[model samples]
Target: MVLFDRILLAVYSLFFTVVFILFSAVMLGWPVPLFLLKDIFYPGRPEIFWPLMVILILVGGRLFWSSLHKPRGRHVVLTESALGEIKVSLHAIEDLVEKVAAQINGVREVTSQLFAVPQGVGIRIKASVTPDVNVPAVSVEVQNLVKERVFEVTGLSVSNIRVTIESISAKKPRVE
Candidate 1:
């Protein structure tokens, strides 16, 4: 998350924490410092209080909804010729990456994720390879293969490709 988002979340969390403590104190009949917010709830000032409530509700509601509804990743605009436009989803790119990675010789299992970058898209791949495979060489191969195939198919430049070798699996040899 960005710095602004972190700060906003911290403020929201602090506000809720204080509110919870105050309410719990009141319910438990414990000594409470209600004076801290006494001016905020001035009974004589409906004009000020109502507007504050409205503003708080609107802003809080918006923030609540935003937290629940995360933003979707951006799509790649492949073509914008005189005739029309073509957009490709990040999921499709991820699928392509997985397929390409699977085609590599020593890869045992593979999954891919994509992120939008300024020039085009960035790819992150996680895979399990055969136990005997060379780690550095295979990693480079995976990266190159994914980048080449994605660009060949989608015509979108891959900003970068990262390959993480999650595990090395050994398959038992069959005895005849």
Candidate 2:
């Protein structure tokens, strides 16, 4: 693909180079425009057609060149045989996971990071649990919640769910 793109870019560059040369020649007092509009409808002096054709060619070439070189759009292809072995957009999946995890009990704040890998989606959840909540139990609940929600929404399995506990607060302050 890269090689093909390079070849296309070279061809486009050559075409533009030719057009530029022709435009420069016209500006240098060449009577090429007379020949272009001599037989066409609305025959007139070559002066008007010369600059118009030059502008059209320049603009058209630029548009074509850019379209050929620039990235087109997101292209995702998944076959039935490889249906369970694909990775989709992680950002979208993460949004769904966060929404579901927040609804779970004892979940203070849910911050998730997701990555699209060959096997499937890899999830890393950074959740702040309430001081009174069990850290291990909450982590397990979050993992399950995220896995279920991500699968339901995206139809892809969660490869790995890593939960990190940032901090734990005391339920009550001790008095002296």
Candidate 3:
């Protein structure tokens, strides 16, 4: 968000916080301006009320509309030949990366994100490893696995595979 949006949200939050505290004080029998505050909302004051309502609605509508707008994912150009052009979804690559990484012995949970690069596509894999597992070994295996599988399936060159060990899970003994 831009600076104006940040300021607006901050002001909006502060306004609600003050309202909450004021209402709490009133409920506690404090000498609050309950009648005066209510008078500010009197139906006779259209001149002041309408402009404030319109401003609130406009700002609120913009925020709501922006929240609904989803960003489009990047697509990789697989091939451009005389026959035709072929492209693959970055989502597909991420799915493939997650699946391949999850199959590795040390990984407990896997998540992947993709980005476009000058050389090719970049894959970032975040994994939760099992306790007592070798991190460097598992990371290397995951990196190699993702690179090979993604290229094999999508025919897109992988610029880099960055493996992040997000967390390590507690070890559980195998029943078998």
Show the lowest summed lDDT stretch of 10 residues, model 1.
31-40
lDDT of each: 0.80, 0.69, 0.80
The lowest-lDDT stretch of 10 consecutive residues in candidate 3 is 33-42
Winning candidate number (TM-score): 3
- Clashing pairs in model 3, backbone N/Cα/C closer than 3 A: none
Which runs in model 1 stand beyond 4 Å of their true positions?
1-10, 37-40, 44-54, 64-73, 102-120, 126-132, 166-176
lDDT of 3 by residue, 1-176 (tens): 65777688778778668777777887888766566546655667888768867887888877676667675756777889999989877788788888899899979778899877788678888989998889999999998888888778987778888889999988543557
Q: What would the per-residue lDDT of candidate 2 be over residues 1-176, giving only the tens digit for each residue? A: 35655566677678668766766776788978545434332326466666657765775676577666765433232334644644455556677777887787777567888766788768888877677788899889888888887777666788899999876754332456
**Error at 48, model 1, angstroms:** 7.9
Model 3 root-mean-square deviation: 4.6
Query: What TM-score does candidate 1 get on C-alpha atoms?
Result: 0.66
Model 2 Cα displacement at 66 (Å)?
17
For every candidate, C-alpha RMSD to the true structure in Å: 5.4, 13.6, 4.6
lDDT by residue (1-176, candidate 1, tens digit) is: 44655676778778779877876776777655465445566767788778878867875876777678767766778999999899988888888898888888888678989876787678889998887889889999988888888889999788888889998988542468
Task: Judging by TM-score, tell me the better candidate of 2 and 3.
Answer: 3
lDDT at 11 for candidate 2? 72
